[model samples]
Each structure stands twice: as structure tokens, then as C-alpha cells.
Target chain A: MSIKLTYFDLRGRAEVIRYLLKYGGIEFQDVRITIVPWGNLKSTVPFGQLPIYEEHGKVSNQTIAITRYLAKKIKLAGNNNWEDLELDALVDTTSDLLEKVVNFYHERDTERREQLKRMVLAETIPFYLSRFEAIAEKNFGFLAFGRLTWADFFFTTTIDMLDAMTGMNVLKNYPHLQGVVSNVTDLAVIKEWREKDKSSVVLANDAK
Target chain B: MSIKLTYFDLRGRAEVIRYLLKYGGIEFQDVRITIVPWGNLKSTVPFGQLPIYEEHGKVSNQTIAITRYLAKKIKLAGNNNWEDLELDALVDTTSDLLEKVVNFYHERDTERREQLKRMVLAETIPFYLSRFEAIAEKNFGFLAFGRLTWADFFFTTTIDMLDAMTGMNVLKNYPHLQGVVSNVTDLAVIKEWREKDKSSVVLANDAK
Candidate 1:
């Protein structure tokens, strides 16, 4: 049975999974849900939240979990015990950083947002991106493994999100990370998907 | 070679992994970092953060990743495909809820904190914990599989954390969730661990 991907129309959290499926050449049903008329669909969601994934009719919520599930299905998880762990770590760190961008809206006019972003730019993003870069440098410039894992894709997604949110380009400071993000976006299938439905994927607020 | 668990002595984020290690009966070198000597130890932490796991000299960060690594090592990740994926989803959801708690602190004002906590208590926590309860009810009353997965432990950990923070017990409204938390804590190993470290584990500020 084809997996059912449920989320809103916008390419927010669910887009990464969609991109993963497209990039991996996997077939699945895309179920787009919007805020309107959620009354009927409310009960069906795992936690009354959208962006759920159903495989063989067993549903799962939590976007990152759905992403990991897709990655696992596509064999995009890293090889070996250590590499797989690194993949999870890298993806999670990326998730945390992206969430900070989300929180920036709620934390406006407060020093907390700037404090948080400063921490991210100063320590968090640089730390993970640099570490991934080192791994890439050691292994022919791939993020986690010698090949592209979900970690690389996740890192690319974060850079895209951050760069879009903040006018300042996040990757300019990290050259190796720039290379990694460039490589992922330059993937043939991904490039095709991005261009094919550019309007659908692009967000108005993401005015880079 | 012994695995090295790097984190501060405080059981802030690393407690779950420590609990899992003790519960699983694995011994590791707990490398407590001291900040009083910040200049010395700052360079060692991968992301200028705590709770890094080093195995065979290779290092990693991200709390969820560390927990998953340990859980996989101890065979606590569950055996079947559905169980494993479900567990991952559950853990990710729990992590999302915890992030809300962190946001509560950053919000500053009592009014903002209350608003955030109410939103969390009303929408986020119940939405997650309730569905998790249903999943647990359907699958042996744990978060996933026939056995306790990292999701179960993470759920229990978050329950303890939320309950302590709000002075409102997680079990008060959600009976099934309370049951799951109880079931996990009642496990022989978890029970013993809690009994031995009651004072330290019970934070005073938990009761809002």
C-alpha cells in the first residue's frame, strides 16, 4: 500500500519528507490538510495535529518522526551503529535550530529572541554545521556518511529556512555548509521537484 | 574501551539516558563537566553543549540521538517495524512538548507563562499524551511494542518533568497516561532507581 502523507498545502515541516520521497523516487499519496474545515478531520489526527503519516493504515504524528520514518523506509539512514546515531543527532540539531526561527515570531520585542538567535548563530548552527563539514571533508564532502543521508538533507532544509527568515544569508559564513546545501539542492530530482511547483512550495514570508 | 557519557552533573537533559543506562544494566564512564573551569573543558564539547556520547573515540550530540543510540544498544528500540517507527514518533512528540516548557522560561512574564502553559496543557500535552495513551492501550500499554521503548521512557521522563514544573500532575486529567507513567516507573529497575535518588530527582521548582 502507498503511504499517505498528511499535512497542510504549504511546504513547511512536511516538505522535507516530500522531498525525501521525491529524491528517493518513492511513490506515495500526498494528503494536504488546511486549517479550514478541520472539524471533520480533527478526530482522525493522532494528536489533533496535522502532518501525520500513515503506513499500512497505522498513523504517526510528529513531523520529525514522520521524516525519520520516511528516511528509514528509503534506507536514507546512515550505515553502521555510529553513523546512524550521528544521522539522528544531526537531524535533531537541525530541528532545534529551525524551531528557534519559529519562536522568533512569538518572542518579538524581547531580548530573548536576539539572545536565542545569537546563541544559534554563535554556537549552535556553527557547531553542528562545522562538525558535519568536517565529516564531509573527511569523506569526500558528504555530511554524515560518505554519501547523502537524511542528515545532509535536513541540514540543507535548515539553511534554506534560516536564510529565508533572516535577510542575512546563514551559509555565507560557513563555506563547507554552503557546499553541502548546494549539493543537496543541486540533486537532479530535487531540483526538478522544486522548479516544477515553485509557487506551491514558496512561502510569502520566506522573502529572501 | 569504555563508552564516555559527557554532560554536566545536573540531570537536566541527560537524565533519561542515565536512567536508561542504569535500567539496562550497562556501565559507562560518566564524564561530568565542570564549568568553573570553563576555558579548559569548553573546547571538548562538540557543540558547546552537554550530553554528548563518545564511543570508541567518535563523538555525537543531541539528547534524543544519544537516547536512541543507548536504547538501540540495549535492545530497547523494539523488534518489529511498526513498533520501532511508532516509538520514534512518540519520542519526537514528547520532545516537542518539552520544548514548550523551555519556551515558558523564555517568555518571562507570569501572564505569558500562564498563557503558554495553558496552551500546552490544553492543546499540546493532552493531544500528544492522549494519543500516546491510546497507542499504549492498543499495544501492551507501553508507548510502543510489547516491551518498553525509548518512547516509553521519554514519556515517563517528560511526565515527571511537566508534573514537577506545573505542580499539576500529568496523571490528574489523563488517567491512561498516568497509568503508562506508573507502569514504566513500576518496572523493577526504574522503580529501584527512583527509590534510590528520590530527593535529587524531585526538583523543588517543579511545582509552579
Candidate 2:
């Protein structure tokens, strides 16, 4: 299969896709663009964005959509349509959290960034993490299912980025969430994937 | 059949779900909540957000997931998994556009809001709209498919929201997008749905 994934070598949005691919043992090109050529490369990509997926010569963009495609290909998606909907809803909930954390991370102004950091740490993180912890608790250490789904991969990879941004273990008090994380990262394939490449797995700040 | 959709009486995020239900010819309890009770109702809803769809007893949040669920029921989703992925990627592209516009619309500071407006108008809107126009032109008046799909419904509904927020006809120069909008709005069921309920079809600003 001529499958190729293209993005900055950052663990920001593309991390979950990478995790899913590694977990599935899918083989394809992992294209990592550095900072210098991005400007020239940006216009050439679809929708002027990173993280485009190419399969059989047809390329597509959008992180979540691409993630779903790979997840389905790897048989990590929900068993039925209704199950897929549940997983999609769960991914979006984590996306809501990721969006907030990303905004804080991307903020350039020092004063405003500090203000956002406070709101995120004080209110936003607890609000979503508490809900997520409860859901993981109910799902038996998974995010939205009894077994590992793409939602687990999504949140597990995302929490690493979130923890990196905050400079602390954000899931310190949420054992279920921490369990979810461990369940994902401790998988043999995932551990092997991480050990395989340390360069392309850099976080957002380090990617810059 | 217990189908219920609860949201503020606004076209902000829930409009596409409303459109899908109308197009599906499905009878649903359209519960329009007013602003006064939102605070109390916020914590009660999953994800603390509006536009929650309750079917039988399963209550779910996240607008896109709900849209896909209703679309599948209505036979508006893609015919296959690959087709669904195509439609999903298209929806996510529009979502990228929507996120930028919503942030611009929701900014409380007047000066920063204006700055966002300029960037949105001069750069972001064109960046997305031109690409959308080309895709529509290729698809012969549809957004992502040769025939009407949920992506069309998504973009058509979202363009209305974007146009209202920008206070201008953003698609004036893009004939294909304009045609896509007209095609969706002129649908017999959608037209009837809107005509029957004017109170709940308000846009984001007026809903406040």
C-alpha cells in the first residue's frame, strides 16, 4: 500500500495518527518537514495545512478525518456505526480540551499567555479532565469503550502534549486517565514505535 | 421513536443537525432553550454544551457526530467508508474555516475583534472560500461529491453562519459556493422546516 503521512515532526496533531499507525503495524512513509521549507511547502498542500495523508496517489487533509481513515484501516474503529459515533464524540471532547491547551501554547503575548495559562490550569483542565476521568473509570480504563479504541489513542497522545505544555503531569490526580495513558503507551507496538524514532516525535515547542 | 435535539434557538452550531433532520423527513422534538436558563442547564448537559441529541435513552454531545448520525439515518452520508472519509475531510476543512470565524465573532475586545475581522476577511476567508469554490466547481455545484452529500449540508449551513457573522455576502464572488448555498436552502424539506419555525432559526448574534 502506497500510504504516506506528511506533517511537521511535531507530536501536536499528528501524534494520534502516528500512534494508531504504529499500533496497527502499518508501513508507510513518515514525511517530516522542518521549519525552513514550510513556507514554500504550505501552499502546495491541500487547504494550506500540515498533516496531509496520501494513499494510492490521492491525498487528503484534516487531522481528525485522516485519523479516522487510518483507524478504520487498522481495525481500531468501532464495530458498528453507532459505536463509531460514540468514538467520534469522545474524540471531539478530547479535541475540545486539546484546542484550549493548544491555544494557550500558541499564545505569543506574554501577559495574555499568562492569563490564559491561569484559566486553563485553574478552570478548564479540571472541568474536562474530571469528566474524562469519570468516563475512563466507567469504561474500565478506556476512554469511551470497554476495549482500546481510537479515542483512547487520541487522548493518550494528546495528554502527553498537554502534560508537556503545562510542564507537569496534568493527570496526576486522575488515576483512570493515567491508566488509560499507560494502557496505550505500554502496548508493545507503541513502545516499539517510540523506541524506533525519537527525532520525529518532538513536541510542538521543540518542533519549532 | 424518541428523537430530541436541544440547543439555543440559534444557527451557531446546531443548524446542520436541524437541516439533516428536516431533510431526513424525521419527526423530532425540537427543544429550543432560551438564554435565561442556559447557566443552570449547562452543567446538566454532556460536555456542558448545547445541541445535544437524545435518541431513545442515549444522550450524546458534539455537533459533528450528531450531524453524521442524522445524516446516516437520512441516507445523506457517503455510500461507503472511503466516501464517508472524503465527506468527513471536507467537513473538517469547513470546520477549520468555522473555527477561525467563530473566534473572530466571539472576541470581546473591540480592537482585537477588528484585527481578527481584517485577518479573516483579507486572508482566512479567501484562503478557505477559494478552495471551497474550486471543489464545488469540480463537483458541479456540490461541495465534495458529484451528488448532494452531508458535506454540502455542512458547508451550506456554515456559510450562512459565516456570512451573518461577517455582516456581508462572503460568497458574493464565489458562484459555485453561492449555488451550493442556494441548492441547500431551496430544498423542499429544509425550506418547509425553516418556514414552519422562524423563532428558533435565529443566527448567533440575534440569539444572544
User: Who wins the lDDT comparison?
Assistant: 2
* Model 2 alpha-carbon drift over 4 Å, by segment: A200-208, B200-208
Per-residue lDDT for A1-208 in model 2, tens only?
A: 6989998866667878888888888888889887789888998888889898888898888889988888898888989878888999999889889899888888777898999999999999999999989899999999876798889999988887788888888999999999899889899989887787665333555444
lDDT of 2 by residue, B107-194 (tens): 7778998999999999999999998899899999998667888898999878877877898889999999998888898999888876
Q: What are the models' TM-scores?
A: 0.87, 0.96
Evaluated on chain B only, candidate 2 has a TM-score of: 0.94
- Which ten residues in a row are the worst by lDDT in model 1 chain A? A199-208
Error of 1 at B166 (Å): 1.4
Candidate 1 at residue A97, lDDT? 73
Candidate 1: regions farther than 4 A off: A106-139, A200-208, B33-35, B38-40, B202-208
Model 1 lDDT per residue over A39-142, tens place? 78888667677778777777877777767767877888866767778888778877777876666634555687787667766876676667656766776656
